[model samples]
Target: MKHQTERQAWMEILAKSSVVNIERQVQTLGKLPEYSFLRSPEIGLTMLRGRAGGTGEVFNLGEMTITRCVVKILDTIGFGYVGGRSKRHAELAAVCDGLLQQNEWSFTVQNQVIQPLQTIIQQKQEQQQRQTEATKVEFFTMLRGE
Candidate 1:
């Protein structure tokens, strides 16, 4: 397996992050540079696939709604694809993606935006895990008349 690049990791984090959290963190950036929409936010549907039992044959489960956008900041282009039909979320994600590619803003965005978003995701996952663990059932076998 190949390791993901830093950009890939951050992009994944952005995609998984909630729009509310993203907007909150991005607000701290103060001012943002001007950008043009290469592809304005558009809503569409993508085929969702699934396996029978995690290892079985793949099949089309259904279609899921998605929003995608593309933005150009200076010479760099950013792309965002997110679940549901939130155009604002898609635009913000694209802006973050473009900013992350710039050397001047990369470090600041990494520290302020990416890290916090990743932490939030981890915390949520941990909380969900704890909740699930609480409902786990244990099975035991006992000898009867041996």
Candidate 2:
């Protein structure tokens, strides 16, 4: 259960990270351990949904392109599902995912790859929010008519 939670957290990070960033992080691990693909990376579509007004009603938003794969490293199996058409990114993410499940590599991956990617994501989001906030418009009720 504990491992599941940690896996979910890292998966979320991997899902959001760019292809280049994820690929780069995986490369930093030097020579990767032996892994066999249980499911080769493949492209697919996922149905997206959204709420009417944040919480009012749910509706089909659209379909999104995604690539996913399953891989085995020793006894552990790792899954990777990421957006877009980057097959290599999906493969690398799966490899990293398998490594992360092992206690021997979990600490290193969490500290090096997952956490750093998360920080990069957070900074990008914050910068976007600031840019959006800067464009806010204000209106006054009483003007020339008064």
Candidate 3:
């Protein structure tokens, strides 16, 4: 599902200000019956490629390790995954997902958490792109006469 404007605003506030404590927001949100079973993963899967040692074409090797988590509120579930090899994140996600499916946690989950996290991830990507563009450098070599 798409994120709401309020979620986007919150994410922007988070991105722009270090003074805004995320944990506080999380805690506040956590108290809501809608966000009781949310989980954030620590790692995820990345595509791996195989290439020759010196100079050769690259080939798709296989899927690399990953981690993921899920947050559930009522009928809504938010799944988060990161690229890397880590079992902890995957386990956390699984547990959240399981909790979401259980009868006890089905009615307390909130959908708001997904939007903020999604916004933060997008913002982080944009920041990385901006930083990369800002730091782009080029060098030219001078030719010498023998």
Candidate 4:
């Protein structure tokens, strides 16, 4: 159970790390087979330039490039590189790329990996909601030094 807790914690971290909308990501992920595994989408930051008042002024805003890999963990058949261009990103894609293909990892991947990943994702969202609710503030005036 504790290992499950730890695994859930990591999944939560990975889920929160991406800028891609998590619910949409999960929904899209659910459409795939149960044993399938999707790597955490890679996201990158970019600079965009814009002008104010019809080109009277210019400014820059940061943007992100997001890439996701969807794979059948059973067949190890999946595609990588949906968004950003980073070697590390590509390497992460590659690990998923390879594991998704191998048959030997199937059971271990499904039980130890994918199921826990989904569970943690759900747990993290609930924890976030609880934290947000806990922070709600109420104001009141108090009698002096009572």
Number of the predicted model whose lDDT against the real structure is largest: 1
Sort the predicted structures by TM-score, highest score first: 1, 2, 3, 4
**Roughly what TM-score does model 4 have, to 2 decimal places?**
0.35
Higher-lDDT candidate among 3 and 4?
A: 3
Q: How far is candidate 3 from the true structure (C-alpha RMSD, Å)?
A: 9.1
TM for every model, in the order presented, reads 0.91, 0.88, 0.37, 0.35
- What stretches of model 1 exceed 4 Å from their correct place? 142-146
Q: RMSD in Å for candidate 2, one decimal?
A: 2.8
Best of the two (1, 2) by lDDT: 1
Can you write out model 4's per-residue Cα lDDT over 1-146, one digit (the tens) per residue?
44566334433333333333332333433333434445544555556677887676887756666455454545455444534544344333333344434566434544544455566667888999999999999989899997
Q: Number of backbone collisions per candidate, in order?
A: 0, 0, 15, 3
lDDT tens readout by residue for model 1, 1-146 = 28999888988898899999999999988898999999999999999999999889999999999999999986789889899899998999899999999999988988989999999999999999999999999978778973
Which candidate do you rate higher for TM-score, 1 or 3? 1
- Give the best candidate by TM-score: 1
Mark the regions of model 3 whose C-alpha exceeds 4 Å error after superposition.
1-58, 67-82, 98-110, 135-146
